[model samples]
Target chain A: MTPIHAPDVLISEVGPRDGLQSVSGTMSTAAKCLWIDALAAAGLREIEVASFVPPKLLPQMADAAQVVQHALRHTHITVMALVPNLRGAETALRSGARKITLPISASQAHCLANVRKTREDMVAELRAVVALRDAIAPGVPVEAAISTAFGCTLQGQVPEDDVLRLAVACAEAGASDVGLSDTTGMGNPAQTTRLFKRLFQEIGERTGAAHMHNTRGLGLANCLAAYEVGVRTFDSSLGGLGGCPYAPGASGNVVTEDLVFMFEAMGVSTGIDWPTLMAAREPLKAGLPGETLYGMTPEAGLPKGWRG
Target chain B: MTPIHAPDVLISEVGPRDGLQSVSGTMSTAAKCLWIDALAAAGLREIEVASFVPPKLLPQMADAAQVVQHALRHTHITVMALVPNLRGAETALRSGARKITLPISASQAHCLANVRKTREDMVAELRAVVALRDAIAPGVPVEAAISTAFGCTLQGQVPEDDVLRLAVACAEAGASDVGLSDTTGMGNPAQTTRLFKRLFQEIGERTGAAHMHNTRGLGLANCLAAYEVGVRTFDSSLGGLGGCPYAPGASGNVVTEDLVFMFEAMGVSTGIDWPTLMAAREPLKAGLPGETLYGMTPEAGLPKGWRG
Candidate 1:
């Protein structure tokens, strides 16, 4: 792999998409746009603006296309959108998303339950999506997110070999990068270290961002484990939002403020400032009132004399 | 260090001392004892039960002696207490604490502001405490916890040499072990890795627990970094309780439930079951009404099919 000038870690904020979606009240399209702009001003280089899923399925994401278009206006940051399947991918590309994330569940049961498809079928769908993206938008990055790469709640104890197989399959199917997700937040540091090591070893540099849930509270720990093993880009929802609906109150994604705080405070250039990013929360909270937001950094106030 | 059976990691629950003290309300002695017992029942081996400061200083910890007595009932678990000075050490010994932790601030400004003593004076106090513990309870462990080991909120960017010197001085002063604390919560994974590596290299096996906070939200990230470099015994709080009075909300120690979940999910044998441990939250939360209780594992329901 070429030595990238980017710092050792990259915290990709998924608040606009994962976080907002989990919130009960919907943010106005204008509000969403403001939050995105605020985040960019806060020095976040990458942000998952929205998912191109069916608006009927998730009304909260009804204005995703508009958000993506606005995010694309700021060319400095990479604009990412989540695509549940081929149709979602098409919507994301049409809306000008430079990067499209495809979710492929590692657990067949989760694949069946979450998106109503078997694991193999999802892989085939991802292959089709990869082909479609390559044909329609060649330079655009295509990521096959192997969801539940860590143990899954639907199907307990996903085999490491199975996760690796799906990752290889995703790569073979033409994904530009293969990411891993701890959909259930059941990851531990040892498992995190071992799995990421195996992933990097087997998949080589094809490993992508770690899309982890804070459900079991290992979000940051799992992220650190991934970082230690050479995975840089991490997908975290602001306020730790976007928990599994099946697990209410669990949807809090690893709070972006906290995640950025964790990385930046340690002197890792996440390219984010805690105070500025924390200030961004006001717009977000304004967008979706009556939401139960969570994050220790913003509430705790910055350490004694902490700087950006 | 003896070659004892090293389970994947060590999670020291600091909710009683570090977690509760950070919050505004004080848990009743009975409530504190109940929570400590619940944590011990959940397979926590080491727990920081209470601080030994004077009642006049931290009224929340006035019932420290009673809590200590309650924690001592569990033979399998080791009871630890925090002390700010020699007087506190005296209190700790009288309470029959098996482990006494002294916070020795690395930042001179933090030392003066926090403990009202200089780093050198803290070291002298640690020496005296060690002597007291040795004389009164030979088998009891005495640890000098170097706070702001990574950086300080009061004095930004504490010198590495200063931290190392403090650790060395504490060891020379007869401390049984030396621990590092991110008092200001200004720790990142890389810095955590480097600081721990340096401490272990400088202090060798004398290095103790990784005392961290979620202030800037890198608690687990820092913990993982420490674990990667061979440091064991992480200090955490149950429900991520305990906000520092001085640094309101800044005291959310690493959440114990989340820490255990992270470890156990990684197959690290924390000997803690998430469900049972989470059950302790209700009682803990009920003890302090209106206080914000923080914990990912408690809020996020356990993953679908976890055995432990």
Candidate 2:
């Protein structure tokens, strides 16, 4: 198969949303804004700034609206937010999120454990959220992220048919884009390529980012596999912040620095300045003291005379 | 390009020689044999048991001869040792090593720093080693490993032409096989595919293992790229041991457990039993107390239905 050599790939930063939500420490609204600013300065075009969940349920994201408002100041960067339901979608719209992502677990077991909803129930909620988004802010793009799309810890081997059926359902329900996520980091390169190629075939341009984890150390491999099969958009966390709590011993999301390095080294433009992106880690480390940050590119430094 | 679909891949474990050599702690000869036995039991057919360097230089490998002798007990497994020169090669042959690997740095600067010899000087030594091997034990295979073949830490951007030229020189010098190593871990998937494809074109079947590092977290990605280009043999360190001392902040070699996981998940047989391979880590950990061992597969555990 011909490898998809995109001129540039969009690296959507999900550390603030997916990362912070999983960690015990809560980054203050100001720290979140500073981190977002640093990320934007490093040439990131899109960032999932926060999740619109109830503060009581996820107190870490209590200042989601505030973080979103601050992020909106950088008009060039697309501010994205995670919305669980119509209520979350309404809050995200009010907060001026340019794009809202709704995570729908492809694995029924994971769906129940994570959101306490059945796959069918989540799809209905997605349709309602899509309708609400259209009614309130037609400009905002609503994306349905199929988490546990590859496989699941609670429920292994999420059928490809089920994943495709869900993707079709989400697209039919008015999702602007539907992305696949390796929630349990159970994806291999071959499986990733096959699944994503199918998704692209089934939904065409509605196919979105490949959200992989460094858990199994196949994050970059899986991403490369997806890239080879024509997937361009990737979701990563700064310093690999968010580990899947459900998947025990799994690492955080693929680190953005390392991801940029991989693409840039391969002559794929990510629009990210390597040194600047690396410099942003300082503020991130400051925000999460004693919290371990992981990325090999930063630790190994750049290759001699390298430029992004 | 058509991907190489090998039915079975050879995973040459390099932890004992490469890993223990770099780390500060010296695993006892008894411990080395036990670790090697555990590895062989896990179905690793080829293992670089020790490096025949001066004990004064590397106290960690002072018992190289003893380790090699012990390793040779496993007649079913190929006992390999690393030799720097003809003297080391002679010692390796006497110790009953089935195969001996001589590392010839592609980067002139790295060659000087590592072995205190120029590239040409090292090639001359390699020729002498090959002559010595043929004279003493024609049955024993002598491999010339082109270190920093991908890129260098001190002198970056080792030209592909330089790598090919060196490989030709080594092959002409009587090496049975010549392999490329990402010594500084400054390799990407694209570079890996291009270089290995060229190596296969120039040397044909003489092209050998892809020795990559997890330094920038592209180890498996680079390996996969090489695999796509028809390189089947892979060199990995169990527990991801052996970081490049010259390559600042570089992580250990590609974790064998993780590599096996990737290939097995893709239905590529490595002949290694997954659980048994993971169990091998216990003895390794016991040997190197307080020394950090790395491998995502061991940490993340096996996938739900994974067998070997």
Candidate 3:
């Protein structure tokens, strides 16, 4: 085994939860386990195995518990799951998720459209999840991922004040960590730096990962801005999956390969096996044949003499 | 006309020169002029109109003088051109190019391959071009674009020392400014920040634009790193033109549309009108009928209610 040491950055993989959920097809439980195994073998320290949502709503995550259990077997990898409310949180805890993310939209319109709840309702839901985590899984961290913190498709120009207010509300409501999500891919570098800086100022250590998208092609830049502002954890997907279903050709989350490549090239340690990470794509593609996978690094291949 | 004011950053369009040079097809002269007009109408302050290489070598730029002359008509825009040697520089000056860029590679192999000259020879060429400028075009600025400043496909991992030394050599040779170019798209954000920082340390205000590529999909992130280190001018293409022809689908230059969107969304004024910029893509597509055009902001459309 490789020597254990904290990496310069943590690129948390969300493909299983976010990528699979965004796609139309449901992968078999066996393929899911294999894909998760490949990612873990590639040295990913954290992997969001699945979202504990109703299988009727998102059939792709029907085997969330089994996926979580398989991922939990890799003690070195922190297993994560997404939850909507108390019930999902309870399921995630029972499945042995080490970390749980609760998506709470900063935009009222998006929150109402996404979960049939307003921002206030999301806050209440976050509180309920936090309480459930404390009682059932005391050590598991509950992350409030503030979606559409930059701008919204339903409403334009999400006020920075509202985002900060929601972040503070989440922290006060007992979230172990509060993160920003550019759910609509409308964030800019300045806004990212400003928001994250404010996050640190208000919530201190509770500031969490930056879940950015490449929809407008500023995903890496936004992540760089967050890193400059001291954000260590990042949420990305394999092959850049999970695009907004309504927006055609919209790149989903920032590609995990690209993000790790950036960090490694910058002389920052990511603790990932680059070749193994790239090879993991084979299982990813095999898991869901005929599904379109997107990533510049994989398509472009590695540059000549890339040590990674 | 909108009020004339300095934008926070200068995004110099390089499609007509770099874009056309890399593509196999030769766009008509009329198409070039019309595309330039569309870009000017979009409020880009500077645009590299053409490259003054011999027609036999690069037939796409055969109409360099005419293109430069046409772009010069827009008094508000600073028309620029690329040159490889003193002969090309002389032709560029005669064509009334307001600014000129001479691509000098920091990697010895790239320098030898690109210009059949060593880095030392390129420095001599820069000196000759500067001398000619002092005689024929006293006011025009000559930019020395240090391509492969970060890394090279031919000789991977271009030393940071070489890039800084070349920048100083150009500046001392009377070059107006020296810029860094990730021609091979092997640049990392940290390397970019480090190299640019060193360039500024050695040759303060003489530092110039960041000519980055999205070969590995970190173009915008690298640009952000340079911007963070006080770079204000950036070179990009309308449709991300001029990729390394050897590598298929390696995104060429940073897309001007996406780069402009990044700066604009950051509230850092690029002075580029958003809708007008998107509209400019129509002329670009028309100019190159069968040629592929690439950009995210163009395909994704504006996010709900973008002010630009």
Candidate 4:
């Protein structure tokens, strides 16, 4: 009924979009809404509810607009969507999403494979998306995330200089905020800390979330590295959903529950109830039956009297 | 073979002792030797080869002396053993252990549950062990690990002042080094960094290894926090072998393979060969048939051209 104090850190839940898209089977539109509503009920202030991609390309997200519409009902949540280009951006804007995130690959090989666009081409597309958003839904923040900014499976070691240059390009192209993503989960804490420090030096307050992956089990550590260097926003998925489905035992975003546990346990406010956050996993499992959910906290449970 | 440069960090392999003892089924003595040989061949310089305990308490460690003898054959490795008290220490010293580690629980509740001794009683036991070591093996190091120094399962939060006081007591009792152990995996990075910092201030160079567990999935993060605060030695179980079996999905030490990967990828010299370390798991699995081996780096193959 009343306003809750803003959490010391902002954890944007990207499970519905990133997790669902990576899976082969499509979760029903109603089930996705239920999951999204469950995440918001657990006190997540932001949720990337959908991705506006064509049905033919990704049938998992064919009901993206409906998911966005349903999530918009949570007045306390900033409903966000991801887009690959200006066309998807137009659709996302019309769907009444409050925030938009555009993915631009730092590794040229990954960019070409995912979107068939060069780095320069993607930046130009980002500029176009920002312009379109200004013309229609003014004040809707557009964020650019540099994917594979840590390293790429194709390129092996992504150059740090290249990542910094591309981040500046996103900022110059009018992205309200720019973030670094370990899309391949090849990042180490040292690199995560260094890159974020350099990103802040280059872009100042324009730096956004640290979207780390647990592919190598260093996700939470990398988040700690980023936080030590002044990162305040993080993007994680519920149940450690989504990943390079191509690689066995690899997953995309860090588990939201575990990340929340690490920060909240350390006396950092995440504004989410630990028990309630753990309970939200049921809706996710219900929506996507038989999927192997990953998270040590969920499996091990919290320490005795962790809340007390 | 020419001498290899010492690694920047030391990874003390504790699986043969901690991991084997926790499981219900016993690994054959020959199999334990084979596993220890593999770990040494992979460049692990120190291995906690066995726990010198009574056969009735843990049949898995029934062949403690034989395993320690086999591990000693490596010559390069510091064959360490865990001793509960003066009796185990006398046997371990007679068997030629290069180092001895005594577990002194910081939490009174854990101390009572584990050794049926109070914290002060454990400190007195440690003093006796150190005295015996000096008479029989003067040069050998006697380390005391303050388990549950971070938090305890039976008794909610363990006070920081209490942990610091225990470390001081261990140092005063002639522990060659005093380290912190997150026996319950309830530690967070902030708590880890703060506690280790205070420990360093109190004991200086006497600070020992950080034995972090992955129960709540913050193991690596906690290790990083300790490392950042100047604690170098780390205790880990290969494949995350040991854990709290009472709680489903709970785990013990940080996975050595993944810990090696984190440091190596960050350009920190672990001195251990990555591929060889991964291969070592085969012998462990062979030894403990049907046991679930855990590690993400082994599950997700290394990044392309990571060696290059």
Which numbered prediction scores highest in DockQ against the true structure?
4
Summarize candidate 1's per-residue lDDT along A1-308 as a digit string, tens digits.
11135665777888888777766678899998999998988878889899888889999888889899888989998999999999999888888899988888888888888899987888888888878887788788888888888887767889888998988888888888898887776777677777778878877888888877766556777777777678888887666656432133455466676667666665567767556777787787788776656776667666665652
| Candidates, ranked, TM-score | 4, 3, 2, 1
User: What is the C-alpha local distance difference test score of each model?
Assistant: 0.78, 0.87, 0.87, 0.88
Which ranking of candidates, highest DockQ first? 4, 3, 2, 1
Q: Residues A125-184, candidate 2: write the lDDT tens digits.
A: 999998898788997899999999988888788899999999999999989999999988
Off by over 4 Å in 3: A1-4, A244-251, B1-4, B244-251
Question: To one decimal, what is the Cα RMSD in angstroms of model 4 from the true structure?
Answer: 2.1
Put down candidate 4 lDDT per residue, A45-89, tens digits, no spaces.
999989999999999999999999999999999999999999999
Error of 4 at A295 (Å): 1.7
lDDT per residue as tens, model 3, A71-160: 888999989999988889999999899999999899899998888888898898889888887888898999999999989988888999
What tens-digit string does per-residue lDDT give for candidate 3 at B192-285? 8998898889999999999998888889999999998999999999878776421335546999988888887777788888778888888878
Give candidate 4 misplaced runs (Cα > 4 Å). Answer: A1-4, A243-249, B1-4, B243-249
Question: Which structure is stronger by TM-score: 3 or 4?
Answer: 4
Where in model 1 is the C-alpha error above 4 Å?
A1-9, A60-67, A241-249, A273-279, B1-10, B19-36, B59-77, B133-136, B244-248, B273-292
- What's the C-alpha lDDT at position B99 in model 3? 94
Measured by TM-score, how close is model 1 to the native structure? 0.87
Candidate achieving higher DockQ, 2 or 4? 4
Please give each candidate's TM-score.
0.87, 0.94, 0.96, 0.97
Q: Ignoring the other chain, what TM-score does chain B have in each prediction?
A: 0.93, 0.95, 0.96, 0.96
Q: TM-score of chain A for each candidate?
A: 0.93, 0.95, 0.95, 0.96
